[model samples]
Structures are given as structure tokens and as C-alpha cells.
Target: MDTQLIRRRMARYVEMVDAGDIDGILGLYADDAVIEDPVGTPALVGLQAIARFYREGLGRTEASAQLTGPVRVAGNGCAAMPMRVDLMWNGEPCSLHVIDVMEFDDKGRIRSMKAYWGELNVERRPE
Candidate 1:
């Protein structure tokens, strides 16, 4: 796994999220990719499921992700990205600090993504 490639891809993923490009974000995943956002919910599997997840999530509000730290890449085809997600929900602004672990396939598509975040990490944004 090329470290630079992984870093570049992950960085692009962040950009897509920030831009609210659901299709662009979904394009980053493999056909059989799985995402366990927050690590406790039922995993979203495959492109269709992943698309639904992003749609419902983004539909809730205007959302964006800003990197809070450097993207960490390993020798393996995996990387960890730290960021803060800002969004409006129920007419209230909210923010969540998150770290997502992404595993890539040999083809450079994300095979798995697991987000690490909890209620404690969430905050109400000031109006």
C-alpha cells in the first residue's frame, strides 16, 4: 500500500464530505464496502446502502467536515482522519469531533470505514 496514495485519497474524501457531495463521497468506496459510523449502529454495506446512509445524513442538514489534525497513514492500506463535523439539526447548530478509520482495497477504494465518536464528543454550536 502506498502511503502517499492513501493520504491523498483520504484527504479527498474529507473534501467531498465538506462539499456535501454525496455521490463523490460514495465513489470513494468499494462495491462491497462497509461503514459502521460511530461503531455501534448496524453497518451500512455496499454502494446502495452507503448511498442511503449519506443521503439521510446529509438530508438532515447542511453539513461539513473540517480536519482537526493530520491524516495518519499506516504501511497497510489504512488511514485515520481526525475532524470536526458541523451541521444544523432540528434548527440547532451542532458539532461533533470525530476520528474515522478507513481501510482501502488494492484498487484504492475504501473497503471499510469505522467512525469513532460518542455523545460526549458532541456539542451544541452557538447561534
Candidate 2:
């Protein structure tokens, strides 16, 4: 797999998220893709589940993510993209430092995406 291509794809993914294009975002995933946001939540598998997850997750507020650093890729089709998330979670504005580890399939679509974040990564956004 071309690492540069994957990096570019991830960059586009972030852009899609920031743009609130749910369908466009889901297009990057393989049919059987799995997402484990924050790594502990039950994984959302398949397009339907993934779509539902993002619809509620992204629809909740004015959410946007900006890349904080380089996209790191491994030889085995895995990449780590660090980003800063600004959103209004449950009517409360907040910021979070996040890293999404995406594992791509041979077709170059994301097969798995696991987000790493924690309570300490959460911060209040000024009113």
C-alpha cells in the first residue's frame, strides 16, 4: 500500500468530518468497517450502524476536527492521525485531544477506526 496515499485519504476524512458530510465520510469505509470511538465503546460495525453512530454523534453539535500533527502510518496498513476536536457535547461546549488509528483494507477503504481519548483530554470551551 502506498503510505502517502493513505495519509492523503486520512486528511480528506478529517476534512469531510469538519464539513459535516456524513455520507461522504462513510464512503471512505469498507462495507464491514468497524469503529470503536474512544476504544472502550462497543464497536459500530457495518454501514448502517456506522451511519447511525455518526448521525447522532456529529449531528449533536457544531463539531469540527483539525489535525494537530502528522499522520503516522505503519507498514501493515495502519495509521494514526492526531487531531483536536472542538464540539458542543450534549449542549456543553468542549475541546478534546484525539488520535484516530485507522486500519485500511486492501481496497484502501478503512476497515477499522479506533479513537483514543480520555476524560483528561476533555476541556471546557469558554462561553
Q: Please list the residue runs of candidate 2 whose C-alpha ends up more than 4 Å from where it truly belongs after superposition.
A: none
Stretches of candidate 1 above 4 Å error?
none
lDDT of candidate 2 over 21-65, digit per residue (tens) = 899999999999999998999999999999999998886667898
TM-score of each: 0.96, 0.95
Per-residue alpha-carbon lDDT of candidate 1 for residues 1-127, written as tens digits (9 for 90 to 100): 8899999899998889999999899889999999999899999899999999999987557888888999999988989999898987557899989999999999899999999999898899998
In angstroms, what RMSD does candidate 2 have relative to the true structure? 1.0
Cα lDDT, model 2, residue 69: 99
Model 2: how far residue 126 lies from native, Å: 1.4
Worst 10 residues of 2 by lDDT: 84-93
lDDT of 1 at 54: 92
